[model samples]
Target: MKRKTLREEIFYKGIGLHKGEDIKLRLIPAENGGIVFKRVDLEEGKNEILMDIENSFDLTRGTNLRNEFGASVYTIEHFLSALYIMNITDLIVELDGNELPILDGSAKIFVELLESVGTKNLKEDVEEIVIESPINLTVGDKHIVGLPFDGYKITYTIKFDHSFLKSQMLEVVVDLESYKNEIAKARTFGFDYEIEYLKNNNLALGGTLENAIVVKKDGVLNPDGLRYEDEFVRHKILDLIGDLKVLNRPIRGHIIAIKAGHALDIEFAKLLKK
Candidate 1:
């Protein structure tokens, strides 16, 4: 398949996940341009920030991208994951804030939007990176290893020291159908006890039962309950897909992650650039 871009522009506005600010985002077609973030709020040069790992910073709650001039866009993983699985290689995302809207804390809404607005194939072929050898990065008990594979796949394992989500693991062959049906709806989760701490630190101000799965000490507080029996692991895989976008191309490999997060995921991406 050739590279693809959005067929038409789409607009969205909602609450930012981190700073709780209202944000607006627009998706526009780009013939052959890869993913680029335009800070409509900035009134200066270099508001256009490429989604590259070198520009990533502050891996606190989500993936953040910063330009040399210090302009930034935060919490981009969910949006990036949607674009990755959609097989979109060229597009322009214009946002009028420093962070993206939380939007239920899953990629489902974005996936649906992309499906409805649709995509148009560009003339260029997608740039891709295929793992030809094993690559491993580890820090303490957290690790993400990539091995040679013909196509993209991931086996993620999350070990939570809690009764509700003790240990959950899943393996997914990354594709549009699998991503949408399996990973996209798995909401980002957090412990109920941590809400006050997160808020006091000025983070996750927009987080709520509506946007995330709130896990109590031994159960969940979300009225809807779990989407998948092992939604936690599925969400980890979902995040891996998004973090991998820092490669700026499609990747074909077998990835195994153990208790990983944005920091470790970005570390792996950085190694791949070497």
Candidate 2:
């Protein structure tokens, strides 16, 4: 397939989940190459920031990228996930804040925005990182394994000690159709206990029942419940798909992850690059 990018720039704004400040983002097309993030708010004396795996920082909460100029962008996984699923190769994401909008805590909003503007194909062949061998990493009981595949495939399993969500598994062969309907709309979730803990630690300040599926001891607290019965696992898969996009090219591999989070996911990508 040919590489694609937005035909025209699109803008979105929302509150930053961590900074609790208004954030604005603009997506613009670029020539076939790799995705780049430019900080439009920087002063004339400051340098522009770019997003890449090597510059990744703060894996605790979300995938963050920082530059030597001290400019940083956070929570880019949802937008990156949508671009990866759509096979977008080159683009410029211009933002005026340190964090992207939480945007309903899912990639659905971004996907819809991109679709609304339409995409234009560049006259360049798509490139991909074809796995040559099985790469495995295990930290305690959490494990991630990558094997050669003809196309991208992800199988994720999440286990929680909580009674409401004991264990759940989901698999997806990444494609635009499946990604939009199955993965993009899956919102991030948290247990009620975790929410309280995050607040105690002064994190996740923008999270709410509207943006995340909040689960308590007995059941979900969100009035509308889950978008999918297996949303928890699907969201895990969504995160994995986004992290894998850091490869800067389409990836042809089969990924199997168990109880893995941001740290392990980034580690797995780093190992694959080695």
The most accurate candidate by TM-score is: 1
- Estimate, for each residue in 1-274, the C-alpha lDDT of model 1 and write its tens digit: 6888989999999999888888988999998658889998887577989888889999967899999988999989988899888888888899998988889889999999999989888787765787889999999999999999888889999998887779888988998888988999998999988999999999898887889999998789998898988888888888889988877678989999999999999999987777
- lDDT comparing candidate 2 with the true structure: 0.84
Among all windows of ten consecutive residues in candidate 2, which has the lowest summed lDDT? 43-52
Q: Residue-wise lDDT of candidate 2 within 136-226, one digit each (tens)?
A: 9999999999899898889999998887888998888988888988899999888877877888887778787767788888889989888
Instruction: Score each candidate by Cα lDDT.
Output: 0.88, 0.84
**Segments in model 1 whose C-alpha atoms lie over 4 Å from true places:** none
Given candidate 2, what's the lDDT at residue 182?
A: 89
Q: lDDT of candidate 1?
A: 0.88
> Residue 271 error for model 1, in Å?
2.4
RMSD of each: 1.3, 1.7
